[model samples]
Every structure is written in C-alpha cells, then in structure tokens.
Target chain A: MDWTKEPEESKVYPATHHFRVIGDETFDAQTLHEICKEYDLRAPVEAGNASSGGKYRSYQVSVHFPDRATHHRFHNAVKAAKGVKVVL
Target chain B: MRIAIGCALAMLALAGCVTAHIDYPLNDVKPQGRPGVAVSLELKDERYSDKHSVATFAHKTGTYNQGVEFSRNLRDYAEVFGGAGTAESWYIAPDRLYWKPSGPMEDLRDRLAEHLKRAGVLKDAFRAGMRDPAGDGGVQNPETRGVQNRGSGATLRVALKRFVALKARRPGVDTFGFFGVSAVARSREIVAVKAEWTLLDPAGRTLDNGIVEFVEDGDGSCWRAKNKPFVLNNRAARRLGDELVKALRP
Candidate 1:
C-alpha cells in the first residue's frame, strides 16, 4: 500500500501521548526531567531498564496536548534534546 | 609498463567526465508561512519489491542510505518554519521494536523535542494534571474539541522510489603474484547513483517530487579506495536533499 497517499485515521484530541526516550550512559535523567517540566509536561517521567551493557537508559514520558500543534511543538522540542538518542 | 600507463590515463579521463543532475518541476504554489501548522514527517522505504527479502546488491546501492540522509536534512530544514513536528528517524530492525543495545541508532525524537523547546517554539504548560489515569487529564480547549483537524499545518510523507548505485569497470594491465618487479593494473571502479523522491500530504495528495542523479569516478589513486564510496554516496545524498528542498519550498 502507498502509505504516503493515504489519509490519516482520526485521533482523539487533547489526549495523553507516551514518548519513550533512550540515551547512552552519559545521559542525565534530571536534565531531561527539567526540560520536560519546562514544556509543562506534568506526568512524572518513568525510568525503564538499563541495557545489559549499562551503556544506555530508557525513559517513558507522558504528556497531554490540546491540539496537533501543541503535540508537535513538544515532540520537536524533545527530539532536539542533547544526549537523547531515540524517541519512540 | 606501457599498458599500466594507458590504464591510468583512461581512469583519469573517466574521473574528469563525472557530473550530477537534478530535475525538479516547479510548483505554482509559493510556500506561505504556516506558523500554526504542525508538520509531521515520515520516511518510508519502498525500494524492495518483495517484503520478505533483502534487495539484491544491484538494487541495494546507496538509495536507502541516501533516503535516510535526505530525511535528516529535511527535518533539520523544516525546523525553520517552526511548529509541532514528529519524524521517524530511528531504524527499527525487522521484527524488533528497537535496535539492539549495541546498535548505533539514537533517539532523535527526544533530542529534537528538547531542541525545539529550548528554541521557545513550544510553550510551557501548567503542571495541573499529572495523575490522570485515562491519559486525557490535560488542559482542554472547548473550541478545538471534536474538530477534524489533523494538525495546524500539514503532515508530509516521503516515499523513496529509486536509489540505485552502479559501477563501471575497465580492464587494466595485470601484474602477477610477484609484485615488486612488474607493475600490473586492475579494473578501476567508477560509481554512480540515481535517486527518485516523492512528497505527499496527510491525505496522500502529491505535493512535490523530483529525481537526482550523480556520478563519481574513483580517483586513480589506490590510497583513497576505502573512503571513495562513502564520499561519493554522500555527494549523491546531498544532491537529493538539495532538490527535495527546492521541491518542498518551505
């Protein structure tokens, strides 16, 4: 199927979305928390398991957006964070 | 000795003939400032004819790699317009939710989000609803509820059509196993790539598209062999990015 041409399915507005972030050992969770707070993300950031190698950590962040614009704004901001390697 | 000289000369001549071309059709619609439009970008790999197997060596070339490069460039470029945005920047292994811990992929979404927040494109919200079990406990605006709005601006989907890498070779003088005394030349590798790109909106409507082709002859020197393909493919990817930007406008 040509996904590029398909219309997006309807999504609930002002809904809570979860973003998972993975970073290397050098990553500081506190800094990320501060940044999330700055964006008005109220949910407590949840930390996940560290890789067996102890080289990386994953964090689950939940935030609510009133509209698509706000969601994107928050998304872009988190994507630009230092030491952040991936956002799922 | 004479044959080796001739082969070297031929390779030099081939290197001199390499060129790049970009073909983009201009769109009448000028890019207007959509400060409110939240742009979400997706990159899909369409290079494989069958979903089950890998692309053949001939079909693999640098197209997927270049597609990746183009996506990064597009995301960085799109940031200037400023709005809510998301991108599929990490490579998910087949049947895997995330890359194995040792793999090199980084979480670009969080990184980009942090950057945008710092830039002040995203506003800070009041920490009023932190423990909503339904995931719907945030501030809501009555005016926006029940509206069929996708985002403020538009969602862009880039489907990669073709990424082909080709090599041209010519026979050269050969020296036997005993090398130091006699000079023998081997076939020289000349590499080239062609990439096709298409841009679409959320509804699958075509926005803009283009094709870019580039060729690079291996410099006749063997010392640079290791880096030649990397350098050449990067050039091709950059060319593709340039054309995409032109087609996208904003």
Candidate 2:
C-alpha cells in the first residue's frame, strides 16, 4: 500500500491545511487576516524568516478546510493577494 | 514635385503592409461558476493617454478594447462556473492621472456594454440590471442591483493600469518591380497592458489583490494593419482574463 498516494475519497474531510506564502519584506499580515476572516477560516499567520538581504518575508498560515473545494478556494485567494510572491 | 511623387508612391506601397489579422478563439469555452458564490465585477479604464507614438512618423490611437472585453469575459466565466451572476460597471478616466467618472466615460461604457451583449459575451441575466443606468450613467448602487443583491459574495475590481500599442516599420530596398516601386517590409504591431485586480467581500474588505501583464503581437497585413490595436489588444485582454479566472477559481 502506497501511503503517499491515498485515494481522494480516503482523505478525511475538515482537515487542517498548511500554506506558506512568501512576499516582499513589506507584506502586510493584516491583509492575510482579513482574507481568512472572509472565508470564515481560523488560521494563525506566523512570520517565518526573511531572505539574507531582508528583501523577502515568509509567513506560515494554517487553516481548517471543511472540504477540498474550500481548501482550493482559500489557496487561490491567498495566491492572488497583493504582495504575495509565492505560495507553497 | 519629384519628392512629393516619391513620397506618395511610398505611402501607397506601405498601405498594404499595415494591416494584420488576429487569430484566436474569441468565444469558444465558457467557464463554470462555483455553486453559491457570486461575483460583481467593476472594470476601470485607468489609461491616461489615448495616442501613443511608436516613432516620429508612426502612431496608434487608443481604444478601450482590452478593458471592455476582459470585463465581459470575466462576467461570462463567473456565471458559467455556478456562481450566481456578475454585476458589471466601467469607469473610464482617460488623459488624467486621477479617475473622475465623466459623461464621455459613461457614453463609452454604454457603447461597450452594448457591444459585448451583441458579441454574445453577456447573457440576458447579466444584462438585466445593466440596461438602465443611473440617471448620470453610473451603475446603480450595488446593494440594490443585480447579482450583487445576493448576500455575502465576492467583488472584483479590475483596473487597466497601462495599455500601449506600438508599430515598427523598417525600410526595404526595391527589388522585383515592374516600374521601380520600392518593396516594403511588413510592419509589426505589439500591444501590451498591465492590469491590477482586487477581490473583496460584500462589506468591501479586501480579500486579495494582484497585478497581471499581457502582451501580444500582430504583423502588418491588410487584416492586421486595418485592425492593428484591436486585434493585438483583444488577444492580450482575453489572455489576461483567463489568468485572473484561474487565480480565483476553486
């Protein structure tokens, strides 16, 4: 059995999804909070480390996804937010 | 007299090489909307100039082709995707650094809305509330208007930051000719645009914001030269719309 390749239906619902968003050093944490609030998700946005030159900032966001669709929607919203450079 | 004749001949010869035709799928695929989500779209034309000079002798006049088409396609895509519908409005602020919605802007908006409807990009449902503009040509208040009336959905604000159309022509030597008519090289036109979009909730709190850039090219052919900016800008606008939808869809 390949644990890494579990079937879609086998995955549990209402799971916690972690997202890492990278942006410029000036990226606003408040914006991320507002976005989470809009989707009615509870996520703690924590600052990570800055690039060597301090030109970029990385933040870790963990939120509860009631379904796969909600998870994708949340990811998309974060991906499109201003000042966000990358999402992982 | 001789210089004038030479210039006239040159102009005549170059005329055929000015136009090019754009080939892309204009209305092929319609995106499906996400169930229970509605989007209200406001397209703002923020270009400050109407004419761009590629060279001392070559220039192109501006139009809102890209902005209008992008808004229309977005509206259609959202509706197709199971979203409730789209409330559409446009604000044109040409030749000014700041935006002030004006009479001409309102006229242009109506013309474009009608054009989109005729192109079949807008459905009847989307057109319902848009038909009667505010007495001043502004869109009716969103709270009381079309799809926006649906509770607690997304609002998309798309601003056209920059739109430029450039044409370059290089002289060619006379070669195969019956009467010394100089052969001309085909001129190429490029259209580029920068668009910024922000997604907000019903209460006007920003959910996300981002910018996208698009550039497309067409060469001088009878079709392209005649359609120059329209062909290139239309392609770029369509591509930009697709990118925005991908970024927003679940």
Candidate 3:
C-alpha cells in the first residue's frame, strides 16, 4: 500500500476545479456565496452530505480558476474561512 | 492572501479539451446496475497476508480423536473445530489475483465508487488493481505509454490476505468428546477477510493506504452451506466493500 509517486503538475486549468468545503451546518449557500463573492464569481454550490449527528456539513463547489495563482489563493482563502474545518 | 486579489494576473493558458460529465451514477443508476465494475485483487503491497499466524498449536491436522494436551491448540482441526465446511484459502505472492466484476459481485466496485463519490472523497474513478488505462492483459498495456487521459485519475485496489472460516472449540475435545455440537447451533463460516488497499492519485501519489479486515459470522443461512469457491469469494468482496468504505475516511 506504499505506491508513492510524484503527482503530475495540474495542467488542465481554465477548467472547473472542484473543492469540498467541510463546515458546520451554517456553512450554507449564503456563507459560500459571500466568501466566494470576492472573486467576482458565483456558481451553484451543491449541499453535500451531513455528518451522522448533523453538526457538520459538506459542500461541493466547482468554480472556474482562471490561473494557478487564483487556484492557490482561493484554496488558502477557503481553508482559512470562518467555520470551515477542511478545504479538500 | 498577498496573491490574486484584484491584481488582474496575466492569463495566457493553453486551450484544450475538457470533460464536464457530472452524472451521479449512484443516484441515476438503477438498482443492481453494473456500470464500469472493475474490482481487482492484484494488490500493490508486496507483503504476505499470513505474516502473523495464530498459536503454533493451532496448526494441528484434523483428527477425530487426539490426546487432550493443553499445549496443543485444537482450533486448527475439524475434529474440535467441526463445521464451516472447510478452511478458507489465503492468497500467496506471485498470484495474479486480478478480478473483474461478475456474477453476485457485479455491482460491488461501482457501488463502492459511488459511495466514495457521494462522500466527496474521490473526484474520478477507474478500474481497480487490474489496469490503469483500461486495457487487456497484454504487452503495450496501460496509458503510461503516452495514452491520453488514461492515467489521469485516482485508482483503488485491494488484495485478499486471509479468509478464515474456522469455528474453534474452547476445549480441545475429540469428535466423540465434543458431541451435540450441531453445525447449525454453532456458527459455521466466519468469512474472515483480510485485505490491503491502496488509493493512488492521477500522479500515482499514495493518497490513502490501509488494511481492511472483517469477519462475517455464520447466520441462519450460509451455515453448513455448500457454496462454491467463487460464491465465497463473491461474499468476501461484498464484505470487503463495506469495510473499505469505513476504512477510507475522507
């Protein structure tokens, strides 16, 4: 189970890069849109599955990142977003 | 925070084809649907499954009558460990344990993939351990040979380590000494499956790797059930899928 190889560089840019935002139940459509609004883009955010106790929720976002820098910036921003536990 | 904030970075990226297919096969597909079912057992881990054997005394041969030596483990023989039909076969090295979805386990891989997809753990799915580029078992195989979009996703594979189906008696008793131990009353087949799994990204990076082990105790059915070898293996696959899901936490 140790098949480790260097990951190929992400070349398919200007494409729909996906992210799963894991946060509390309050991380709903409004929170997502508000955080992503600074990028001047809005895409449908799919409210994903919830934890067994319903305390946490996960959302899937497929927005376009025009460049690698944008991708990294958006990833760091989401990771540091309030109430968000993990940006994967 | 100091990058890409209204800086208007120059975007001179190359134009290329892209796939925007976002069909939820788990929800859209019907019950028992077999789509892209590629589950193989050719594990990448080169370790032996039976690295840890039980008590050395458990390796005794089956005998209807043997001396009551506490030092000798009676779990290995059918005399004290009657029922469960036969012991499960553990795979060894150099065995090409590649498998394709068929028969009872036709929907196993697809279902597992969909479960992970629903959990958002995996973005793309491919055939399990068999082939990365979806090709036959021949020379010039796989996409590493310059085939486009073949090895551009995550792949998962599992290998069977052990299939223990033994029901041991606490006290080593001879067949006559251990009377009235009906196979029905006692659990027969404990389909103990030990499997190692590896999840790799598009670049062959090991995203997650772990071992999944579970035991299915004999229920009302399957007890003394004369199932073919393939049937047992199919059931093992089914159990392995569920265990895999639990082991693979995002």
Candidate 4:
C-alpha cells in the first residue's frame, strides 16, 4: 500500500496497463478464457467477488503492454474483438 | 387636524403592510430525481513528509485495499480474456508525499482513454482545447472498440484523491446526545481510507463529486486467521468498481 516506502533504487518494472470492459452478463466465461489464451495473457475467473445486486458479474483484465504505445495497440485490438459490449 | 390624523393612520397602515412576518410552516418544493449513477476513483495521496503515523496507515490501507479489489475481480476477468498482466503501479516512498512515476500515470491514462474511446464519450470528456491531443486518437489495445461518436457532447473528467477516516461514532444511551467515538477506537483499532473523485465537463464546467471509503476493524482473536486486510480491501474494490460502472452506463 505504501508503494513509496520502497527505496528509490528499487527497479520499477515495465508498466502493466489496466482495462475495464463491460459486456453482456450472458457472455460465456470459457470463451473469455480462450480469448485471453490467444492474446497471451492470463485470465482468472472470480464470480463470487462481483456484486450480486447487479444481475451480471463484471470481468476485469490486466494485460501487460511493454509501453504506452503497445498498450494502445492492444486496446484497439480488443475493441475490435467479438462479443465486447464496451471497454473502460 | 382631521387631515393630520388621517395621514397618521394611513402611515401606520402602510408600515404594517410592509412589516416582515414570520411564517410557521416552510414552503413545499418537489425534489428532482437523481437520474444516473455516480462512480468515483482516487489515488491515495502519498506526501513523503507525513508527520503522523495515522495518516500513513490510512493511505496505505486505502491503496492496498483498492488494489486487491481491482485485481481479484477486474484483473481476473481480463486475465481470463488473455490480459493477465494487469496490476496497479505504485511507489511507496513512505518518505515522499507524491511520487507516482509518469509511466504508471501514463499507463492509467491510456487505459482510461481506451475505455472512453469504446464508450464513445472521448471527445466530450475534456473541454474545448483541454483534451489530450495524443489520447484523442484511438487506444492501441486489442480488447477495445475504436472511438465512436457518442454525440451528446457531454463528458466527464475526474480528479481523484484518496479518502481517510476522520471520525466514527456509536449510538449510546442518550438518543439525541450520544457519546461519539473516533475512527481509531482503542482496544479495537478501526482504520478508514477514502477515495475522493471530482468530475468536470469538457466546457470547463464542474459536474459531480463523490467519495468511497474503506473501513477495517482490527482482529483481536487471531484464532480465525483472518485474511490479509489488503487483499480483502482489493477484492471489495473490484466489486465496487463493477457496480459503479454499471451505474454510470449512459
């Protein structure tokens, strides 16, 4: 939590970008898993953690992009992928 | 004499007419509905020179909890979709107040751009000439939709801040004047952190503001082997974010 507590000499790793994508509740978890596999990222399923009050459980992805430029590229590609309703 | 008397009476009547009156009941006005859902996110302030341990504890608790929530829920989903390396970038100078590196900030900004672009609210998100020219173009990630024109021309820019617990209270014997307590209660330490966000429109108009607070009660028993407080906080945040996004759906 206190990231700053770490020393300055501590090497900062290559930035890992975050994306929040919204989609239909009915979308299959397995399919999402497959898509991640194709993209070379890991997909972890956490169904119970989402708010039950909302009809659908939201999914989150943390894709590794070498840099900002690559992150943009990845974002564009995901946007074009099938079954995505929206991304945030 | 008659004219003078009449004038005096008239003056008294005029004075009475203009006199202020105290109304017992107040006017009734209809309240408007809050149309949409409001969501807020904030980065904890990390001033290096914090003198108090309480402040430091509050900041760390908030950030850790938020990260866990985001990772467990959103990161999990993203990973399932092949985006496994999603995590927050943080620097804990514990000594410095604000030292978030540019790389992390840019990473977050890019992600936000990607989300907005997909939502079709990119253009209006920032005011005229205030928009990030670089981000105006589409994001480069694989899991997003290109910039679509969401023509409402209404968008929001959010300035985020971490939340801290200032006070807490429990109802005592006295109904109206009950004994109050602080967030940091003794024998059972309670810590709280807040995520404060402020939203503004593209035309430089301020629109909305909100705060999300995370509270944790100390574990005295150690019998149950409580889950790491940071991890629980993170998990909760993912739930909170998902709910927030749903509420903000345009």
The DockQ leader among the candidates is: 4
Best by lDDT: 2
lDDT of 1 by residue, B152-187 (tens): 110011101111100000012110000000000111
Better of 2 and 3 by DockQ: 2
TM-score of 2: 0.24
The order by descending DockQ is 4, 2, 1, 3
Write the residue-wise lDDT of candidate 1 on A1-88 in tens digits. 1212222222234455555566665678887787787554646787764543455566777676666567667766665777765554
Question: Which digits, one per residue and each the tens of the lDDT, describe model 2 over residues A1-88?
Answer: 2222322422334565445566664568788888888554445787754543455566766677666577667877886788876554
Segments of candidate 4 deviating more than 4 angstroms: A1-13, A38-45, A48-55, B1-162, B166-250
Per-model CA lDDT versus the true structure: 0.29, 0.30, 0.29, 0.25
Worst 10 residues of 2 chain B by lDDT: B175-184
Worst 10 residues of 3 chain B by lDDT: B176-185
**Candidate 3 lDDT, A1-88, residue by residue in tens:** 1112211224223444445566654454577777677663535676765543465566766566665567668777776677765554
Top model number, TM-score: 3
Cα error of candidate 4 at position B45, Å: 21
Prediction 3 global C-alpha lDDT: 0.29
Docking class of 3: incorrect
